[model samples]
Target: MSTTQIASPRVALVTGGSGGIGRAVAERLGAEGMAVAVHYAGNRNRAQETADAITAAGGRSVPVTADVSDEGAVTAMFDRVQETFGGIDVVVNTAGIMLLAPLAELDLDDFDRMHRTNVRGTFTVSQQAARRVRPGGAIINFSSTVVKLTLPTYAAYAATKGAVDAMTMILAKEMRGRDVTVNAIAPGPTATPLFLEGKPQQAVESLKNMAPLERLGEPVDIAEAVAFLAGPARWVNGQVLYINGGVA
Candidate 1:
């Protein structure tokens, strides 16, 4: 690219940026000239690795640890933004946990874990973005197609994302007249660590074939959807964009 074509950078915060779709979103946003705040729940090494990759790509990023579900931790995480990037422009709430158990078999503790991270954590990060980000900034939350599929064992996990989708619409309306946008992305089946857990290789293969596209989504696929929502897709607001490869 010519020097004259260089774009000015912006600030982006991606919770759970250490792994999975969060990492892809951070890297993609970084490539788009957004300085990244890579928030991790506990994995400093992975978060730093993500930040290092961004730096190697000629984009700026910083790794910061926060629970995302904890109000104080979430607040402190934003405080670092004040020091590192002055103010934030885009906030992506990708920090989520998926605990699969049939509704009758679900444990309360597992339910809390999913709710605390997927639902409450999203709320914490989104509320922070709502309060602090600039006029054209955004709040993007992660949902899952499991909410639509109603997959048997995913009862608790799906419940949380269902709530996220509902809250996203309400929050978008709550923003009322602000130039900023709020939206959610419900990815179908992505090839990510979380998606692979406990499944045999054959099962994974079969899952991939379940999509009409005949392949599981890459993390980058979802990240690209997120990039559009966070940056260029201006008219798309208060909607849940499902990147499911037409699985329905």
Candidate 2:
């Protein structure tokens, strides 16, 4: 049977759905016959484009705008999803920012901004999902392979993902009987606008070759991992699945 013929329909909220990985995940989930709420912080146009593509392909979707770090905004976004779809079955927190600088040269303000979006944003979204997501649902968070790679100039960024890893484990245990699986996906050197912006061709090539696959991961690669956790990987909970083609 095709995904569209699945007996039960699921609803998913993918934050940062305007960008590369998040948009890919949203589109993939929509193709799986899930109603998707594509959440964007500031790019409503891109979000709408994602929703339109999903709808045109015979899936249901809507674009939502919210600041993930704002408690009230995130809450309202969740409320909108619940009202639109009855209940949320999957929540993917892909909204994040990366600021690169060696610890010694990093601006404190930059560090704070990263923490606000990457760490606090995940916490706020996870809190809402824990309270609202239905049984047998999944909550997927985004981490980074840099957390383990320990690359210089990524200290601030990796710190935020480390917090994400910690939260994923704790949230999984907290929702012990809720039947909601929580996990994080760590992608290495993906070809996203966020990753490519301001990067030199030489630097990009170096990162591409670091992986055993000898290529940078695509957004679709990470989306496939998310689809697994969201659909059939019930036993895989509270772990960070590194989807970087063995780059760790």
Candidate 3:
């Protein structure tokens, strides 16, 4: 039999699947027997590596590319996935950018750049997912616990996530009776390249100690939450789940 014929009926499109946390979520969904569409903004090679890993582990996947902030590009990516896998059962939006500066010192241009990717990207993908995902599916978005922490340099970044949290709840209600759950995962101080890029050892240690578990969150930790919401968490709609190890 052909691989596509034998593949699982479920399909998942994971945006930013080349990144740390996103890659983990994609692989976990793949392991759950869902055919995955790994979406990358630019790094097709890394995305393909993720897909290859999934395929090696007995799952089917393809690497897709698009700028998540562009509605047309995102829609095209979704269309391609549907054409390949029949339909989408889950949509996970994990593409985002973080630029830290105190509100007083932050450049408006930096804020706009972050918002364009984080807020606009989530909105664009969620819009497509709402229109396309099959019932009994899910739309998982990325948020940050920093919204509650209210850290000084994170004002602009947190604002973007605040929008995400608000949108998540409203989208859940908007999808009423559609059997599709909309939720956001708010992870705190995850040890991804994006989070660790320029931070010194001391800063990283401080964040690790803040969590009661006394360690930085791993990509797998957040991925486990994605797997839950993507699958059997039918009743867990319209909530921003904080996977920060008791940090917030």
Candidate 1: lDDT over CA atoms?
0.89
Q: After TM-score superposition, what is the CA distance of residue 124 in candidate 3 from its true location, in Å?
A: 0.6
Using Cα atoms with residue i matched to residue i, what is each candidate's TM-score against the true structure? 0.95, 0.97, 0.96
What tens digits encode model 2's per-residue C-alpha lDDT throughout 1-248? Answer: 11222226899999999879999999999999999999999889999999999999999999998899999999999999999888999999999999898899999999999999999999999999999988888999999999999998999999999999999999999998778899999999999999998889999999999998999999999999999999988889999999999998
Please write out the lDDT profile of model 3 over residues 1-248, one tens digit for every residue: 11122224799999999879999999999999999999998889999999999999999999999999998999899999999999998999999999998899999999999999999999999999999988778999999999999988999999999999999999999998787889999999999999998889999999999999999999999999999998878889999999999998
What lDDT does candidate 2 reach at residue 176? 86
Give per-candidate clash totals: 0, 0, 0
Model 3 local distance difference test score: 0.93
* Location of the lowest summed lDDT over 10 successive residues in candidate 2: 1-10
Record all residue pairs in model 3 with backbone atoms less than 3 Å apart, i.e. clashing: none
On the 0 to 100 scale, the lDDT of residue 4 in model 3 is 22
Which residue pairs come into collision in candidate 1? none
lDDT, candidate 1, 118-141, per-residue tens: 999898888888998877778999
